[model samples]
Target: AFILGFALKDILANFFSGLVLLIDTPFSFGDVVALSDGSRAVIKKIGLRVTTMYLIDSHSEIYIPNANFQGENIINLSRPTSHYYYTISIPIKGDVDPARAISLMEKVVLAHPDTMGELEGKLEAIDNYYGHSGSGVKQKLKREVGRMRLLAEQDVTRMLLKIEMSLKQLSEF
Candidate 1:
């Protein structure tokens, strides 16, 4: 009984520590965090001495020691409800009006099938100082486009990729 109690105490301590780390730490389950080497991952589990995450590009799972996580910069995409903001740049030559290009890009982004009904969208152009020199116009956009009620991370990536391709095509035109 004494040995069992000792083991149980250690287990309970670890579990509570895991829970506390989950709350106090910057990253949480399902957050896409960028590691030191620019490797991105979506956290899957927060354990006492380790954290489990899936790499974004390769779909590979990784276990990171919690001790190493201290002071590490992590991007938490899950805490704010899985919404993401991205900028799309479109280069326009002297012939094309910058305002017109901005408007067109906004239309394309807002009209995209993946972006249309999924989330509220905001599209706008960033100011460029040069005003010429083959300068590109940047559209600052934000969306909560991924479906949260169903589908897993892979499905979300596929949807995002589709949206990205559509945006690229629009920019090319």
Candidate 2:
């Protein structure tokens, strides 16, 4: 009995932790999270006793015990929206015009296909700069904007449906 208890203690703890995580759902599969160890990873799967994650920097899979995962300080980068703020610092010559440099940098970043910025302004800026260079940045930005809009509309529709169902139940009572 002592041997069995010793062997099953961790397993039972992990199993219960997994159950709590599944119910509370702080993060889900495919969500990006920053671990307490300062590593960023994407959650691949949640299992009975462990969670599988793909580390972004190492490009490798890591399995963490549910109990440990539950105890750690994990930042869910994908929650409240999948958008996270990033910052960069650049050094420029003192002789350069600061305003011009800042403007140029902003335009360059806004012109990137993957960046999130005002759609119309980005399209106009891309058109002015690329001017049919055949880089396809404008088209890609349009497609991405369309996809985001579609996802937002779907979420609104889902919420409306839930509200309608709740109202129906209230009326029945």
Candidate 3:
């Protein structure tokens, strides 16, 4: 009985610690997290001594040890507050006004309903002459991609709901 109690106590401790870590950590549910070995997963649940994550490309669940979580650098792609940045680059090869291009891209990003309130967008130009043969006109665009990613979330959920409904309808048919 005493051994069982000790095991239970340890489990409880780990469980609460996991909860605390989940709340305090940068990552949250549905956020893409990169592990140390370059493996990436979407957070499903933060469990005791284990975090349930789904591999982004494979759509498979991966139980990551909590101990490893502390040592590894976790890149959280989603957080309510601004934590990550996404960039879209457009290369122009001619007598193109880089500033104007940036402005246009910025406007397009801001105009999107998904990007309007949640994320802030910035545009900059990088003249890459040394690295490449041609003068690389790179427009640096930054925004919290996860803010707009919620739209994808909603769309996926809506799609699943639609599939379920269709299945039900077909069953009746």
Candidate 4:
């Protein structure tokens, strides 16, 4: 019985931590959050066992265990209303419900050529990753491509940051 209790210690701790997370509501779905690992992604889903983060830059989803949250700090990038006013300016169909609107937006964004290309690159890299069946030249090219994509993403993110700063300045004035 003592052994069983010890064996279940971490699991119970994590489960309870998950409950605390739910109660606290520190972050919500679609809010971009940063983890201890320096990984920043949009919070997609918060489950009892795990929190899902969707990385738009890489077009990938990362599942983080709730226990990790208890051990580390999380930064919510979507907090405070006056500074960052993010809104979707798209027009929705008259008959579309909230769920349908969300689904449509997701589908439309994911279907964009640039998004699709990035997504494919991400998929290819993940699939071949360290387990490449091709020659060194092909592998080198693949990695180079991935690097280029990351650099491009970083540039875009930086540009967006600059734009936001400018907007903030304008709003202040």
Candidate 5:
């Protein structure tokens, strides 16, 4: 009995940890999360004892035991919003006007329809982006991105609701 109990200890811990995760639902399927090790991955599946993840940096699948997963500090990047802001550093020469360079870079960045800017300005900049030739293509790309974001959000919400209902049913048992 002692050997059997010792053998089952880790398994039982993992099982309970997974159950708590299901109840809490910190992240849903397809949500990108940063682990304690500073690695980022997308949640693929949550099983009773293990969670499957796709590592974004390496493009590999990893199955993490639920107990260890629960112990790690994780940040959900896909929750609430998926807009990831990044910084880029540019070196300017002594002869270049810093103010003018900065202004031009800002305009270039804001010209992309996917960036955060006034809707009218972004739409207007599409003409500048493609020399006024691919305006229709730019508009279509923007619409597609918007639709994908909406669908991802809806999927997360739906999954959360289903998890909540399933937990409620389990509690009654």
Candidate 6:
């Protein structure tokens, strides 16, 4: 009787906690959250016994006990803004100046007209680079791109490339 009571206590706690989480809205569907284990994932669903999440790094779904949040911090990356941001990395030659690279990137991004004007697309260097070892390349740009702009730019780029090829063929003929 005593063991059953203790087991039921944990289950009841989880059930109630799940209800509170659903109502409180600490996170929602598709909202990305960082778990205490350092796993960043998107909320897939919330159930009575567990909260389901799809881990970004592992590409797997995990069930976190409803009562699990009590022990760790949950960083909600999407709660602040509905617009999701993605990183676009640009690799420059080792000898190229960082400032000039940034300026050229700005021009290329601004020319697209889809970067959402005056957005000041952020540029920051990342540590990972795969150039020749002796070159000492210290600059790589990471820019935040909106979902819509990313898709649109991809389509536009493909179309422009096709057009360029057609123009070249016409000139040759």
TM-score for every candidate vs. truth? Answer: 0.37, 0.49, 0.43, 0.44, 0.52, 0.46
Give lDDT tens digits, candidate 5, residues 56-89.
Answer: 9999999999999756899987654436578887
lDDT score at residue 38, model 1, on the 0-100 scale: 82
Give candidate 5's error at residue 165 in angstroms: 5.5
In candidate 5, which residue ranges exceed 4 Å CA deviation? 81-173
RMSD in angstroms between candidate 1 and the native structure over all alpha carbons: 15.0
Which 10 consecutive positions of candidate 4 have the poorest summed lDDT?
Answer: 108-117
The per-prediction tally of clashing pairs is: 0, 0, 0, 0, 0, 0
Q: Which sequence of candidate numbers ranks them by TM-score, best first?
A: 5, 2, 6, 4, 3, 1
Q: For this target, which candidate reaches the highest TM-score against the unseen true structure? A: 5
Better of 2 and 4 by lDDT: 2
Candidate 2 backbone collisions, by pair: none
Give the whole-model CA lDDT for all candidates, comma-separated: 0.56, 0.73, 0.57, 0.64, 0.73, 0.64
Tell me model 2's lDDT, rounded to 2 decimals. Answer: 0.73
Candidate with the larger TM-score of 3 and 5 = 5
Q: In candidate 4, what are the lDDT values of residues 103-168, reduced to their tens digit?
A: 545554433222323554444444344223234667655556545544555554465567667767
In terms of lDDT, model 4 sits at 0.64
TM-score winner, 1 or 2: 2
- Between 2 and 3, whose TM-score is larger? 2
lDDT of 1 by residue, 11-78 (tens): 56656555556546575445677888788898887777678999988889988666566557776644
Candidate 5 worst ten-residue window by lDDT: 126-135
Please give the RMSD of candidate 6 to the true structure. Answer: 17.3
